[model samples]
Target: MRKRGVKSVLDVATGTGFHSVRLLEAGFDAVSADGSADMLAMAFENGMKNGDHILRVVQADWRWLNRDVHGEYDAIVCLGNSFTHLFSERDRRKALAEFYAMLKHDGILILDQRNYDAILDRGYSSKHTYYYCGEDVAVEPEYMDEGLCRMRYRFPDKSVYHLNMFPLRKDYTRRLMSDVGFQRIETYGDFQHTYREEQPDFFVHVAEKEYRMEDQEEGSYGGAVSTARSYYNSPDADAFYSSVWGGEDIHVGVYAHPAEPIADASRRTVERMASGLGLTEGSRVLDLGSGFGGSARYLAETFGCFVQALNLSEVENERHRQLNAKRGLTGRIEVVDGSFESVPFPDSSVDVVWSQDAFLHSGNRLRVLEEIRRVLRPGGRLVFTDPMAADGTDLSALQPILDRIHLDDMGSPGFYTRELIRLGFVPTEHEDSPGGFEDLRAQLVTHYGRVLEETERQEAEGLGAKVSSDYLTQMKKGLTHWVDGGEGRRLTWGIFRFTLSEG
Candidate 1:
């Protein structure tokens, strides 16, 4: 408070008035508030006894903090794990907005919450520290679930109280604070700057309200590189995919020949890839970067295999869930929201790891390969296709294509072979599907261009267009580059089959 020049401070959740009384004794102008009138009254009494002054106490809801609290302050302290009281994302965002509105230009907001992710992911055993603060009082979880952690508190008199709190993940809270316009957020675990994630019983996030430019690196193709946040997670991407290619699988297809239909080619690719691995009933499959789970559901339906499809996009995850339910394949295919870089399962848990045109999106190919290797059971197969650069190709020639997908560059078959062998995997099959890129690019150009024209005509009649013309423009450039197949810039589409060593 002294360093930040904080004079007047607002304790947003001044439970029992302990912090307010301490602030008053420390000679700082303290204003305390709580959502519960009873708690505020108790805090007021506690303040009178401790400091012989009636603490400025108010009963106010955090969502409408500005409406009840009159003026902005130099600092706002929302401590004591009070933030988890908000169960809904909407409420959390609204409360954070209100908090931001009630702060000085350079004021700081300190909020603390339990590391619910640690409790949920690993069983919780309290360090038995200063929480509750009184030896006579006892606190423990009575009921716990992913969304809610209902804690039971026992008073010295044997009376009981319960607090229903939403289990907020640390990273999620930081992301929410960022989304709510916090310029800078510094997090400390158990009041220390450095600690293991699981070791922390509580996390304190001090967010500053200041204007800071977004950090991004310039790319070769006049775009931001991997350092930039993904637009793939945005609603615009979802809206484009939902409208333009609604209900259609959005991925590259395998051309059995030069003139196969894109949809048929997609199914044929999955079938051919599955056939190489002898995918059959009861096999457990893992699909990384599973876009809307098209191939997962197809494999599950055809081979009766159980597939866990992991993807990073929430929009696609929800869509996949709904689609799976509608198609009666929910039992066979489980859609998980995650990244392939950190496969959220035990090692040696899957029989096959499948992907299609998705590996290019991952910048760290070695980490991706390591994760793929870890999740595969002994003798498990990895069958997937990715866009690769031809050997001895100049990567500078494909900056346009790389920028369109937010990638550094494409990987080659030799690169995959070397990485797989180093990771104790044998490359069993290396097939460069002949003319796959040329045929797929041509069909996409024809089909997407026609859709763009039809949608433009419909928009002229006051109907809605599903895709933006900007997408079409980018698609045209990329497709033209592939069709042009310039000497060093041509994309080589190849399928890789690898088996983990039984030893």
Candidate 2:
């Protein structure tokens, strides 16, 4: 609490004023609140006895907390596993909404729950260490199902008490907190940073109301952003990509010639995607997964459009900002360090959304598309390209390629078209494609082959020494898999254009 700058706290589940009195002694303005009047009364008495402190107490139901308890708090502490008592989803949501309403704009909610995941998955087992450490007491589950965890607590006196809880799973609780508008949530196991999922006796969640861009979670969509960020920010990756892909554009290209320079062919791809967008001066463009701001700079410079370059790599974003500044496009191109899965822009705010060979990195391509749909204005254009699996190809055959990218599946042309139509995006006409702007598929074997040869040449010339031998070997293997996949008709790559439905 002190680290988070919390001075005023609302102990919402102050069982016996244990936390409220402690907070007061620790130089905090503490208010004790509980749904039970008896609990609040006991808490008040305990507060006075513990520290001669008068804990301002409120007897209020959690679902209607603000109806009785007024004033916002810098922090709300709902400990003691009290939240699991709410058996209904409606009650849980209402209570969480009340907690959110009672918190300041930058306030935080620290809540804890028993590790019902472990108890339900594997039978109940605990060292009796952290939360219930009393040597004379024993706690075990009396009954457990998907919904209920009835615990039997036997004290030193041989007296037994039972607790009926809703058995909230870790991920489910996290999702509820997120659904209730908590922007960032960090869960700790047994109050420790390093603990296995099934090992923890309790999970403490610190949910922040404020949204910090730098502290965004890897998200439930498959941890792709985190993986990509780590990979691209590495020294070898930066050095190798900068050397081979011309530092500006790292995506696959539209090869005009078999031996075309990687940078030129990549620029042609950007041009092809942008040609049908009808971009005008000052048009707003969002470049998702914008690597090194290559597409962003091109779109901004050529069409005089303002581009928001959203990417996960700080290393790449820094380089992108530097390039934007160098080319006097800083005002036109804004580099944002973020994931495309959760774009930090308002709904219907952009005229165009652009990406290239990037959506393949998303664990949840559907979520990425939904975010794109959210940010794009009515009638806005979405033009981009990605490396995809060929329709009807057995995904098992692509395991080598999948292992290289750490993905289970790749989006296909069929998947994109179906999803785009479902998301209210109408396919626009493109002159180069035969299938009415739907089928612009191209095999990337030539592009990858060219890159591999150039990289080898660069290595022979000692210009690529910064790239480790192991990395080069892995790159060779990965590129070979891609080439084989492309040649075998198991992979496809191409540009897709869609317009948000005006209706």
Candidate 3:
């Protein structure tokens, strides 16, 4: 990507030369390379049709890519599920190492493949989101096993073509990428930053050759051994949020009015709370539990502030990077993959500490607050919204909500005020929005029903449905409990504002 400082590119598997030509048009110095001379000839012809006389076109196999393709490049593009063509592990490793050898020290490699795990584990059909986007072109796997996946392609005129490919598992490909000396490799599902790993038709891996400096590992918390670690680290966390929230912004949306868009309301809530913090250009902000970094983006774009987002989920953090790049706000927002308990920042560093409904995950709420206080500069503001229990509620009545979030207890406004006072924070204001809960609850039920209906329709039309049964079952239960005629007591939502008093 341009954001990653890529100025020169090599289209490694330049089949038909689509990517190479596009890169050339985008002002990047691009060279096209392919294993087959026939493919290179076709690619050159295609480039010529687009008024491009490709400067370099080389015929080279991937295993010895560097030998044939001279000179290093800032980036290498190996797309269109071409990597699976290498059937053996030695060939795969050699091809990857050659790719590494061809890249600049700080170069990057972008590669894509079929979601073969879906094909090998659970029978999956292509939705044509990535590879076969043209109408009248059908692509499907006719035969699949642990190693080989034979695909059948049907053209418009009923012309058929078949190709045999190794079914590379997602994890296996990632490990290969890393083992081949790529310092960082970020994977995406069907060009989306957030998705269930099992549901996507294709996976894109962007491997970086730059060596990233390691962060300090000493005195960390809530990792591996922590209960909160297990909750956030599980694959279900990514699946649940990505499927239900249905967007890059993976937090609770506050719908002030039914007619208003949920996303708009969510942004409004962020802006409202952010305004109270007095953020301005160049202000340093810390976002706690920054899920998919929705609020961090909002802060950076709206106020021109630098936001450091701390989160526990690596999946969400990866999504955050993609979203930030897409918005061209990557420079303003930095995502840290860590727990909030230790706050991986120096004291008195941030001007504002912002969070949204993420504090209850802490088994040690007091320690979290203490870390927040330690990180804030004197007089820095703390603004956050949290879901809490209603006053005079029966403890037994809150079990379902607790079970839903895997929390032992929900924090109340009173509880937060007491804790803030103990930490020497001045509790400035609190806004109770009970209706927000009702609105979100209704929206969840409606969204679930819509998803189910669409899935059923797709199934009837002989399309593969990617919906998870467990997610639907849980939603139905929650909807039954929280609706107007539900048995469980309603939960409360509140926005709290605090400022650290200079000691």
Which candidate has the top score in TM-score? 2
Question: Which residue pairs overlap in candidate 1's backbone?
Answer: none
Q: Which candidate is the best by lDDT?
A: 2
Task: Point out the worst 10-residue segment of candidate 2 by lDDT.
Answer: 434-443
lDDT string for model 3 (1-503, tens) is: 78978888999998888888888888899999999999999999999899756548999988888778799999999998899998999999999999998989989999999877667655867776566748877778888888788988899888999999998877678779878888556677787755654488888888888754333322364422144543454344566555445355554445565445445656666767776566799699999989888889888998899999998776778878998999999889999988788888999999999888788777667778899999999998888776566555664677776666656676666677788888998865434323211213443333333444433444455322343344345555654443421223345555778889898
lDDT of 2 by residue, 1-503 (tens): 89989998999999888888888999999888888889988988887788689889989999989998899999999998999999999999999989999999999999999978667655788866678848787888999998898999899888999989999977678779979988666667788643422367888988888654433455522366666666676555777888887569988888887888999988887887888678889699999889888889998989999999988877788889999999999889889888888898999999999898899988888989999999999999888888999999999999999988878899999899899999999887667753324343453888888788988888787643355455677898888888888888999888888889999
* Alpha-carbon lDDT of model 2: 0.83
- The alpha-carbon deviation from the true structure for residue 328 of candidate 1, after best TM-score superposition, in angstroms, is 1.2
- Candidate-wise lDDT, in order: 0.72, 0.83, 0.73
Residue 443 lDDT (model 3):
38
Show the colliding residue pairs in model 2: none
Q: Give candidates' CA RMSD values in order.
A: 16.2, 13.8, 11.4
Task: Give candidate 3's TM-score.
Answer: 0.53
Q: Clash totals for all models, in order? A: 0, 0, 0
Tens-place lDDT digits, model 1, residues 1-503: 78878898999999899888888888789899899999998998888887596899889999889999999888899988889989999999999999999999888999999967657755566786645557777878888888889988899888999989998877678779878888457666677654422356788888888654323211211122222224444333555544444234666555555444455656666676777577788799999878778888888888899999987665578778988999999989989877676678999999999997777766667878998989899899887777677666788887777766666778876677788888988765435333111223343334333444434554465232322334445555655655444323355665677788898
Worst 10 residues of 3 by lDDT: 432-441
Residue 15, candidate 2: alpha-carbon lDDT: 85
